[model samples]
Target: MEKTLSVQGMSCGHCKMSVEGALKDLDGVSAAEVNLEAGSVDVTYDSEKVTVDAMIDAIEEQGYEVS
Candidate 1:
């Protein structure tokens, strides 16, 4: 499934990559795209292996906030 999450604290390409990398590293995540300008992250992942809450936590662990 795909999910779009509102993310904050992304100010540059590096920040975007950080969020993307975090999400991609998760077992169920197939892809992740972070838009710094829109402050959002679009991710394609397996719902059976991962949850939205886990995605939020991964983003937050990279110093970003998900709303």
Candidate 2:
């Protein structure tokens, strides 16, 4: 499934890359598109393998906030 998460504290390409890498490294995630200009992340993941909350945690782990 796909979901768009609102993110905060992203100021440049590095933040975008960091968040993208974290999500993409996960087992269930198929894709993670970080739109720095829009402050959002479009994620395609398998729910059976990962959870939305886990995705949020992954983003937070990268030092960003997901709302």
Candidate 3:
């Protein structure tokens, strides 16, 4: 499944990398693409192996706010 999450506190390339890296590190995630200008991320993952809440937690752990 795929999801687009609205995120905040991203300001540059590193923020984009940080958000993408955190999401991609999840076991079920296949891909994570960040739109820095839009303050959002598009994530592709297996729903059976992961949950949206978990993904949100991961992003939060990286110091980002997922709404």
Candidate 4:
């Protein structure tokens, strides 16, 4: 499944990398693309292996707010 999450507090390359890395590190996540300007992330993952709540937690753990 794919999900687009609205994230806040991303302002630089490091922020983008962090969020992407966190998401991609998940077992089910195949891809994570962050649009810094849009403050959003597009994630592709297997719903059976991971849940959206987990993704949100990952992003939050990276210090970004995912809503």
lDDT of 1 by residue, 13-62 (tens): 89988999999999999999988889999999999999999999999999
Off by over 4 Å in 1: none
The predictions' CA RMSDs to the true structure, in order, are 0.6, 0.6, 0.5, 0.5
The digit string of per-residue lDDT tens for model 3 on 1-67 reads 9999999999999999998999899999999999988999999999999999999999999999989
What lDDT score is found at residue 66 in candidate 2?
A: 84
TM-score of each: 0.96, 0.96, 0.97, 0.97
**C-alpha-based local distance difference test score of model 1:** 0.94
Cα deviation in Å at residue 57, candidate 3? 0.3
Residue-wise C-alpha lDDT for candidate 2, range 2-60, written one tens digit per residue: 99999999989999899999999999999999888899999999999999999999999
TM-score of 4: 0.97
lDDT of 3 at 14: 93
Ranking by TM-score: 4, 3, 1, 2
Listed per model in order, the count of residue pairs whose N, CA or C atoms clash below 3 Å is 0, 0, 0, 0
Top TM-score model: 4
In candidate 3 the C-alpha lDDT for residue 64 amounts to 92
Superposed Cα deviation of residue 33, candidate 1 (Å): 0.4
RMSD of 2: 0.6
**TM match of model 1 to true structure:** 0.96
